[model samples]
Target: MMEPAVCGEPTEPAAPPPLLAQLRAWLAAWLTDERTARELVDYGRVGHYTLALTRWVAIIGQLFTVLFVHFSIGIALPLVPLLAAIAASALVNLVLLWVLGWRARLSERAAAGMFVFDLAQLALLLGLTGGIQNPFVVLLLVPVGIAAGLLGRTFTATVTALGLLVASLLAADPLPLPWFTGGLVFPELYRFAAWAALSTAILLIAVYTYQFAEEARHRAEALAATRLALAREQELAALGGQAAAAAHMLGSPLGTIAVVAKELVNALPADHPLREEANEILDQVHRCREILKTLGPRRAGSEVDRLVRAPLSATLRDIADEFGRAGISTEVRVDSPDGTPEPCLALPPDIRHAIANLVDNAIQFATSRVDILVSSSHERLLVAIRDDGPGFSPDILDWIGEPYLSTRHDRGGLGLGIFIANTLLARTGGKLHFGNTGRGAEVRIEWPAGALERAVEEREHDGGHD
Candidate 1:
């Protein structure tokens, strides 16, 4: 016997590399793309939040500074200058909050301005205190850290560099640490360590936040695409019963018209001019009757209960024609066992939508041509879609048909197209298989004879309650 076709044959795409290797590759790609490296988050309300947080921090910091000065512990900080800086920052933040209340979103420039002002206040506070030797000096980076996570690289880098500059300057003449008695002195090594720690923290936090934010955005978009596809499938399924009812109702009225025309032809005199018109009406009635006969009886089989109960081959052709209109070349072929009737494949709306999605995907990926094959044998039905283009990438080959696993992100693909298609087909007792030819991608869908028709009927029956 001939062997069954394995998914990744010699002609197929190669397997993906190790997970660590793949991670490194994606990380490199993301870092090189400035937009991707920048955090993707809505900063609409962040300004208001930042201003509020700063106001509270300033108020508390001022209160502490006043109490420390009264005790005259550490080298007495210039208490008046420190209090003035805190008051200035508080006034600025209050004004910002009032302005933001009427605005929907903060402009990047405006947000950056506020952060710069905060950084300036932090530097002044450090200058009055113990500079880098003061434990609170680390707080100088707070505004810059927030900016790095929400702004572009140019802005983030600028803020970070500015913060480091201020810290370096303050390190030269910072007052001694506060104490109940004499001020404490810091060693040179501790000063260097503090500077290094702050710099490292800023860079690492920016990169980590950017990577995670990008991932979250991508996932949300993919889920949305999946929901859209499933919703369209449900809509098509809902129309199935209505289509069947219309076809069934028209059959009886057409038959009555045919009977009336035939009676008129017999009653008219052969020599009368009206006789020929009656004959024409009778002839047209016969044509309609012949068409209605194919629709079958309303109560015959579960397959006939849907409006979209066309043979599988016809449905495929229609889908192909739709793509042909879009300028894509499509070829459709069908193979059936000898003595097997045509129109053997039954398609409800859901199945039809699923097939269309598969066809659309093939056309999109194909370089110049797409081939659709329908066949039946030994009580089984099958459909195969082939495209003449570069096949699936090795990294994503095994992940095909999985949600959020798209290789066409640049094309606005959410990676849910194949997943949605597979899910819809599964509901109708069909299985979707993916593979790669040396030249391109291939998909195969299979079902047992009469299986899909029954599944569709059951789905419709269940849907009636809600």
Candidate 2:
């Protein structure tokens, strides 16, 4: 016998749910979660005009079919009910157009509701005509398929389930098929087979359509992100160029100040107060010159020449230095196969930024060391960045450079770094390869000899003409 519960005492906690029940609950929660839906399904916008136009077409088709069957074929359809259903659909479409202007975009819920209405209307028509026995019963898959492409999984599943329910009900008991003689009757097994076929088709079509649409949407979003990242890298490079220009312009003034300060210090007595002030001025001028030196290439030449060209070794070394972290050691090595001098190529900002991004990614993943190797020959140039850490996951290795494909969720990145790097490199006629080299992951980028250089030169020439 159970004892009476006390006011403050807690009752025994309910027994844990059975495994099947728990699984069902989990699935329901996952399907209903709004955040998951938004992330998985990016149904951008459904315009009112588009929905209205499609509805108008469907209405016209339905009208034509009903009129032709009833009058031309002399088959007796429940004309009043059939016409009423079509008119109801038209009226609903009209109301939608009136409330939401033609150009207005629909919210996900509203779009889903419109699809539900379409499914209901189609179901009603099928039930009246002959349910699954009618050839037109196949139309039941249409709304569900469309919804799967444009709506979230929850809404799509709901529509599909609704369609299945309607089909089942109609198959069990529906109006006889119209005929010139009496109403045509179908076998129970035939009706059941038709229902099964339609249900299977709806599920299959919905799944396939959703998968294709989702993949296309993901690709589009990833491309947009890649473009944005490239634009940002270009901006930063432009800012660096501006800094070089500033450094160039200020060099003469700073030198003049240093010279004036030195003269003042030499003219005055060693212990004079003005001499100390002059010495301070000289020190500041020296400091300013040092700061400017770090801002741009140290080579003595026109600003454009200094900023536009760099040896492959120097570029790799600069990137390694920039990405060096306290725990990681970055090394850059350049090899010339024929014992020739290092190639001094036109260094476009896009290329520099792409190299830098790859180096940074390597550093982020490396346990202790990142190595950048650049090898050039008469035929091709190759750059490989390798990291001594856990290599690429086997599952995603084949998809390494694709956008938003990353195994580094621990690093809190959207996985666009590699994609952006790959895209920028490709734009400059480079091909990238990904692999693991026993110790860690390696990304190899290759370009035909002189390809990048010629590309850059042509771009500069075009810019000059522009």
Candidate 3:
């Protein structure tokens, strides 16, 4: 498999470079690549709106040229004035496109300010010619859509007010589209009123639609976070139960080695190299005994995974949101057996604790971003947390969630989080898995529900007999 790029290991040292080397390096990296193109998909709306605005500008320019000639034949103002105005309109449109480009690439705050510039330019254009009568005044939709899509509720409302104020001021000031089509196209009292009513309706709908879409997006995100939390709990439980069993299964074999080593020690000659090696073997047995002693008092061979249960959406969302508020860009998406959020029953806090630990683990290493995805089959709820950070070492990946295996030497090898995480999950009846995910490592919590239910049932059966 390809090595992960962002493993959480301490960064490798970079070679020194000459001055202006930084600038050149920056420029070279900025040269667009596949990733650049992929990122640009987010700017598709800006590209689309640019084209729409460009088309309007062209159409309005042609209309202006024709109107200017007709006005020159009879009006008091010089043909120069109208032509100059037309030139100015075209120049402003060019600037609008430029600003639009900037808005697409910039942050939300910057985009809001740029949108103000776009609005003012269009409002100015409406004032120069005819406000409501300027057929192209309907071009207001572009900026309105921009506001609705990019601006927050307050900023959007502000933009709407400015647009309406500008439109009303221009509408009352009758500027005509220079009619070169031989007949003057002018709106009467009722006609202009109707146009304003219809356009206003359209603009309001766009704003409302934007708000609806944003709300839906937030709800979906919340749902997803909930699912991931649930999965993390389930997966952790499963991991723990399996590890405990594996630890238990080793006991018999380890005991046999201890017994055989005792026999060999008795058979070896005194002070011999062979006897010294047998003594070493006996020490190894003692170490093995020490290791297994950590398993505490287990009912030997009983199901440890029996207590784990899959978590619900509400549980997962809280985990993601809690991390997100701490400046980690956390996102959660939840998929149940039906691939939707249905009412889930209450689950234990152990599952919640196991998942929060996973999120906290990622928050520690993530540069700025974290994602949690939750899905479950009939058997297990799979919770995966992926981060934009350095990932695990190969050895760590192989044994992560296993008791005593750790990657944290930086903080003095405090790895009990994984041990506890694994133990908690196993106790609850799930599994905790850790590995590198491309630029970061992913931790998966898998809960096998049937095994847990079976274990619970077996306990109940034994209780009844007792």
lDDT of each: 0.69, 0.80, 0.61
Instruction: Tell me how many clashing residue pairs each candidate has.
Output: 3, 0, 37
Which residues of candidate 2, in runs, are more than 4 Å off? 1-45, 67-74, 78-84, 152-169, 172-175, 180-182, 215-314, 320-329, 334-346, 366-369, 377-379, 388-390, 393-398, 403-416, 450-466
> What digit string (tens of lDDT, one per residue) describes model 3 on residues 1-466?
8465586776757678866666545543442233433322232234324543654665486456546545655433234554554566567445545434333343344445545656666666555555677666676766667666655666667777766766677666566654444334465784468467746864686678677656554445444554665677568656646655776789889889989989989988797688888889989989877665444233323333222223455667777777564557887777777553432433445545667878887887888898888776665667788998888988667756543345767756445566666765686567777888789989887767454444444543442231
- Candidate 2 pairs with clashing backbones: none
Q: Decide which is better by lDDT, 1 or 2.
A: 2
Compared with the true structure, the alpha-carbon lDDT of candidate 3 equals 0.61
Q: After superposition, how far is residue 175 of candidate 1 from its true place, in Å?
A: 6.3
TM-score of each predicted structure versus truth: 0.61, 0.66, 0.44
Please provide, for model 1 over 101-164, each residue's C-alpha lDDT reduced to its tens digit, 9 standing for 90 to 100: 4322455555566678878888877776778887777676677767766666577677777887
Clash pairs detected, candidate 1: 73-179, 74-178, 74-179
Please write out the lDDT profile of model 2 over residues 55-163, one tens digit for every residue.
9999999999999988998888898999999999999887665555577556566677788899889888888888788999888777888888887777878888888
Off by over 4 Å in 3: 1-104, 180-188, 195-199, 223-260, 265-350, 353-466
Comparing 1 and 2 on TM-score, the stronger one: 2
Q: Tell me how many residue pairs clash in candidate 2.
A: 0
Q: Cα deviation in Å at residue 417, candidate 1?
A: 3.6
Alpha carbon lDDT at 128, candidate 2:
86
What value does the lDDT take at residue 43 in candidate 3?
A: 28
What's the C-alpha lDDT at position 391 in model 1? 73
